[model samples]
Target: MDLSETNQTAYRHPWELSRMEILLKELEKLNIRGEVLDIGCGDGYFDKEIIKKFPLITNIWGVDIHAERCVHQGKEHYVNSYNELQKDKKSLILF
Candidate 1:
């Protein structure tokens, strides 16, 4: 399937929406306030949503094997591997 089509499907799927809702609820409970590292972040869609919902997040980064697919406001926000991301900063990691 086309990547664009897959993204459209994910947005439209009830199960996928519900899953994201649940994940967001869980994240809300944490009251996280810091950087976030999303591993295997495809297209960085969830990362965008996360930052939008949680303004306390100072920064958000995406790590994906297919780095070219990651869509972020800034290119530096996406990396090809965890090792490429700065290790010193404390961040909430999402899979």
Candidate 2:
């Protein structure tokens, strides 16, 4: 699916929207609570999505190869590599 160059929120592939909801629901059902490090987090979009759905997550951090594409909605931090975030052992890694 191709997203519009102007606004990503205005356009999304079906899988992009559905998968995020499914993942969030599964995470909630599992009742996982801890700092979360999202790997390959493009623009931190899903980071915002998960945090919005699961308030139990104490800390949210995002890592991606393309640092220029990273985005944050709240206190979330975006890094370029897993090694940067892996220095802290407290986070629950997600891909």
Each prediction's TM-score versus the true structure = 0.77, 0.73
Go through the candidates in order and give the clash count of each. Answer: 0, 0
lDDT of 1 by residue, 67-90 (tens): 677744448665555677777675
Considering only N, C-alpha and C atoms within 3 Å, which residue pairs clash in candidate 2? none
> Against the hidden true structure, what lDDT does model 2 obtain?
0.67
Q: Of the candidates shown, which would achieve the greatest lDDT relative to the real structure?
A: 1
The candidate scoring highest on TM-score is 1
Give the CA lDDT, 0 to 100, for residue 68 in model 2. 64
lDDT tens digits, residue span 1-95, model 2:
32223255566567778887788778877776778877677766777777777777887777666666664343355444556564656546787
For all candidates in order, the CA lDDT equals: 0.73, 0.67
| Alpha-carbon lDDT of model 1 | 0.73
